[model samples]
Target: MRAVIFGASGLLGRSVVCAFNDMAVTGTCFSRTAGGLVTVDATSADDIERLLSRDQPDVVVNCVGERRPEVWAETPAQARGRNVEAARLIAEGACRYGVRLLHISSDYVFDGKAAPYRPDSLPNPLNAYGRWKLLAEHAVRAACPDAAILRLPVLYGSAQFAAETNLTKIARQVSAGVPMEMDDVCVRYPTHADEAAEVCRRLAGALLRGQRQGAVAHWGAEQGLTKYQMAQLIARRFSLSAGHIRAGEADAASGDRPVDCRLDCHDLPAALGPLRRWLFHTEFPPVVEPWLLPARPVSS
Candidate 1:
């Protein structure tokens, strides 16, 4: 199958690309080292249309969107342009080209007051990031009904951690003996990019085979943990003291954010015949410790 992945240089996108390595995969990187790959600005509709038309892919995976809460808050318009408008263009191009679209969404679509959100749960986002993502979902659905939307939780991997504060990022801080404070108030189901990538490939394949994923399908671990818990796990993994990492809450000082956005794992299991989970997440701080360790030169 011919597949085109937007924002392929990012962690989740890269993972998806790796998952579909056997297939003909084309990637879109923005302002990052292309390494002999296609580079496209995700926010530009003309660029997106040209690429989609040029490739005429059998499947298009959108991993491009504004994920930073700060960016969403600071520049709401730009965030919407990147996250929502960009999605609209992609869906349009997909519909025009008669291709399946697998867009990566976020758990932040919920208000977080709820503990576990089902795929059909009504989304009432508290922050701008969530709001924009929800809008993007709507735009995609409107443009392409068969588009499979996969709502994910916070993702972490060796490929991309500098932009987001995932387990590995916090682990790096603790590894360096740098004290860190994690938000305990915001409950989340942290997912590894590899896990999400697997699900993406499965769903995309299903979609290509004429199986619809309904309006949306969520893929995440059942267990939910806070940033504090992740930090503690990291500390234990590296044999560092967890005391330095204290519990935190994102109050007014931290800007608007939901308290919890743990997604229900039932829909994925029901639709996709049992959701696949990462052993690293369940066994965290250990199964993933080696990957989080600082990189060094290999001996000749």
Candidate 2:
């Protein structure tokens, strides 16, 4: 099956592309630094159409998101254009070309008031990124009802593009002996990009096998851990010195980050069946240590 991936160089996009390598797949990547990839403008429906006609992919997965949270406030327009507008264009193109779309979303849609939000829950996004993503999801559904909207969180992997991922950024900083300060209050479930890709692949397979009215799936780790706990886990996994690592105040004022954005995947697992075990059991490659804590200085 032919699959076209937007933001292919991203963490989740890479995994999705790699996951489909074994299948009868023809992959096309849309990016500014075009090489063998198609330089389709994500916000332009015409460009999307031209590229869709060129590839004629059975599935089009929109993995595009403006990830710079710090700059989101200053450039809300850019963020909206990239995240929401691009998704709208993709949905329009998908409906026009009769291609099913898998638009990736985030867990930040919830206000953190509840743990494990259901697919039917009404979204109450606090931050600009979350709001834009929510808008994109709405647009996609309106344009093409047969679109899989996967709401996930905190994706991490070894193979990353130019900008480092959350885990990778922390790992690199810790590895360099730089002081690491993590929020001990805020909690999230970190989903490995590889495992996420497999889930997405299974969804696509299910679609190909018939059931194509579009479904929403939430995927993530079983345990909801804080940033500090996640940092400690990584330190332990890589055997990094945790002495330099410290806990910091939660950025509660910046955006409404739910204390427990934990996703309940009971229904999702039931749908995926045996693949659910593979999802959790899939060990993250030993790029760094699992979880570690600094030793306390003792005085005699």
Q: Provide TM-scores for the models.
A: 0.89, 0.87
Report the lDDT tens digits of candidate 2 across residue range 196-295.
8888888777776666357877888876667677667666766667677788755654456667777766666677665543231235434333321243
Q: Write the per-residue lDDT of candidate 1 for residues 1-300, one digit (tens) a residue.
A: 899999788878888999988689999898676666698877777898889888889999999987775777788888888888889888888889999899989988887776678889999987778888999999999999889999998887654444354666667666555566668767667777888999998888889888864459877766677777777777665666667676878442365677777887676666667656786544565435654556434589
Q: How far is candidate 1 from the true structure (C-alpha RMSD, Å)?
A: 4.3
Error of 2 at 199 (Å): 0.8
Off by over 4 Å in 2: 22-35, 161-163, 253-255, 276-285, 288-300
Looking at model 1, report the run of 10 residues with the lowest lDDT sum: 157-166
Computed on alpha carbons, the lDDT of every model, listed in order, comes to 0.78, 0.74
Clashes of each: 1, 14
> Which candidate achieves the best TM-score against the true structure?
1
